[model samples]
Target: MSAVAPVRRRRPGRARRHRQRHGYLFIALPMLLFAVFTVLPIAMAFVLSFTDYSVIGETNWTALGNYTRIFHDPYFTTALVNTVVYTLMYVPLGIAVALGAAMLLNRRVRAVKIYRTMFYIPVISSTVATATIWYWLLNPQYGLLNVFLGWFGIDGPAWLHDSTWAMPAIVMMAVWAGFGTNMMIYLAGLKAVPRELYEAARLDGANAWQAFRHVTLPQLRRTTFFVSTLLIISAFQVFDQAYVLTKGGPGNSTITLVYYIYNKGFGKLEMGYASAISFVLAAIILVFAIVNARAVDRENR
Candidate 1:
């Protein structure tokens, strides 16, 4: 034993160790808060999804009963379908509108700052107020929308009241309220695009439209993907507009997954079912997010 000596691993210097500690200290509060607020709630919800914990009622373990019941739930099916439709409508339109706004704003025109402020105002305004405004504007009989439609001799249908048109009405309002944020994101992306690309395109006799299609679109691919993912996520979680404008009314046409979850958890006190639906929605969102990411990545390849 006296002839053998163990070699210890070297340790980091005091300054290096102190810097690492400081770095961890900087992140500790955020990680702690995330665990407490986000991770804990998700874990609690996952557990509750397997049990019949109806808030005030006796808690009972049902295994996969809630999840199994989801397949048979008509409301869930309708809500899921409605959510998909909303996402489909919103994601493309939102991207287009945001991109268009970004392009227009990128122009070095006079008073462009004021135009930006006006566009961004809705993004910061109260959702309730925005919904209220849209509600007024969408009035079939007394609304500005109908008035404008009537100018073209095209009678706008009862927007929020008509089941067929309700979801679309919601989509329009959401796009209007949200495109501002996406516009700013796209504006940043546009700014980052190399001016040399535009110059090369111009040198090659590319017009504005051609330049946009070839240079701008290709350059903003990543930004578009980011915006699409955000739009997809937000579209699936759409609750405020539907709840405010229609309350999932007009025969549940506007009933989103989140709205359905709220109705179950609060309205019917079916916390277990709500949690199960929430998890299902989370899964669906994950799938869509993955698909979009892969789709964009594939294009890159």
Candidate 2:
């Protein structure tokens, strides 16, 4: 009578299945939208990259001809080089400005929110509007930038008009417009850094610079990596500023990969070739991202 049969707990298979069904239903709309908008377009572009698929006329397969043509295309080469140069200049400067701004604002000083807002205003401003303002500022004559230069008896270059200065001008504008967001990111990272670490550093006779170099920077490695990766991608894909300011002009000195792709796809109606070049650009961005991720991982280890 005391030896009762052992009871086994039954699995909630039906309830679990019901919950999973709801989860799928909840995500169905977003999944469908992503598939239709992102996945399908990428697939179509890849397929079209293998063909002579201009918007008009008959389409025909061209195999790897489109890819091959990119290597020999002078405009493409120039655009690629310009894009690389822009990325090289933009990423470092953007990081420096953002980090410096973040460090400045991380203090317990009064009116810090006002300063943060002022810095972030440009990030929220429309790209077209920002570029327009910069356009006026960089004008060869009567612009504020050159006017200030003249106060010191310094002659200013024709920024957007001069081939030598056009890309640098774009880089400057982009950095000004973009660094605010990264500054906010850095601000968040700085906030997350344990205050105890700084106190510890102080107790160890470390000065402000030493604490920043050893503790602050080390703690913010992940944040720096994330910010750098984003900056690299955005810098590589730069187009709107160049389009609005110079229209890839001054002898193509300001032409970028995205600008070149736009000219090929829409301006020239060479969609297939443009798609091929775009895939190449995608490959380059992917490589940089992977390298950056690996570097972060190595540092963490």
Candidate 3:
């Protein structure tokens, strides 16, 4: 019989080195694009935030002046408050509604695919179109929503007109438009949960609520964290709906951080001040995201 030759295995150290080199190739394009579009812009904005640049021309460095003005500016304070209120209203509501919708779809209901498609339609629709439609729907005199309320002997207030109602109206529209995508995400998370856990919960005399609380929710924690983080950031950056529906009107009730930034950058041509505000928004988002990550990491442990 012929002697068989021993097969040589690749060394782990060499293999790891190859993998590390290959990793850079895969990541190079994305890193390049991010540096160009995201990192470089952020750096530029940070530098500009300390200056007195405008559409006219660069004047001189006014270190911390823009940030100092932010503290004293009543409009900035109001915008910050409005943005916070909007985030509070929209984020929780969106997550709850999306979770509810996702749970419904998780059941073996008829036409589930169609239902998911219907729910997701609003998310993919153009924001401008959605805002325009919602604007008409919330109109005081001739809106469908008011007509329906009138039928039930309830007076519907001017939704986007009165300052008290304007922000809430925008919040409602935002939730409707935003939740569907998160619902799909939650649905995917739900699907990954083990059916055996539900069976075990039932065997232990657990009710539907108990099964969900014990098994489903625990499994969905990561997804919840991701969705909440995204929604919170988006809520802080809301601008298009306000621009189209209320124009930050009804006494600046719907003005948000992003709207304020747009007014400073484009309307007033104060790029440096706008950059300062943008950095503040970035800081807020970063703090929240860090908190969320830590909370999720603790839960995972």
Compare candidates 2 and 3 on lDDT and give the better one. 2
State each model's CA lDDT, in order.
0.96, 0.96, 0.92
Segments in model 1 whose C-alpha atoms lie over 4 Å from true places: 1-20
Better of 1 and 3 by lDDT: 1
**Residue range 169-269, candidate 3, lDDT tens digits:** 99999999988999999999998998999999999999989988989889999999999999988998899989999899889999988999999999999
Most TM-score-accurate candidate: 2
TM-score per candidate: 0.93, 0.94, 0.88
Candidate 3 Cα errors over 4 Å, as ranges: 1-29, 295-301
Worst 10 residues of 3 by lDDT: 51-60
Model 3: clashing residue pairs? none
**Segments in model 2 whose C-alpha atoms lie over 4 Å from true places:** 1-18
lDDT of 2 by residue, 1-301 (tens): 5898889998879989999999999999999999999999999999999999989999999999999998999999899999999999999999999999999999999999999999999999999999989999999998899999999999999999999999999999999999999999999999999999999999999998999999999999999999999999998899999999999989999999999999999998999999999999999999999999999999999
Looking at model 2, report the run of 10 residues with the lowest lDDT sum.
1-10
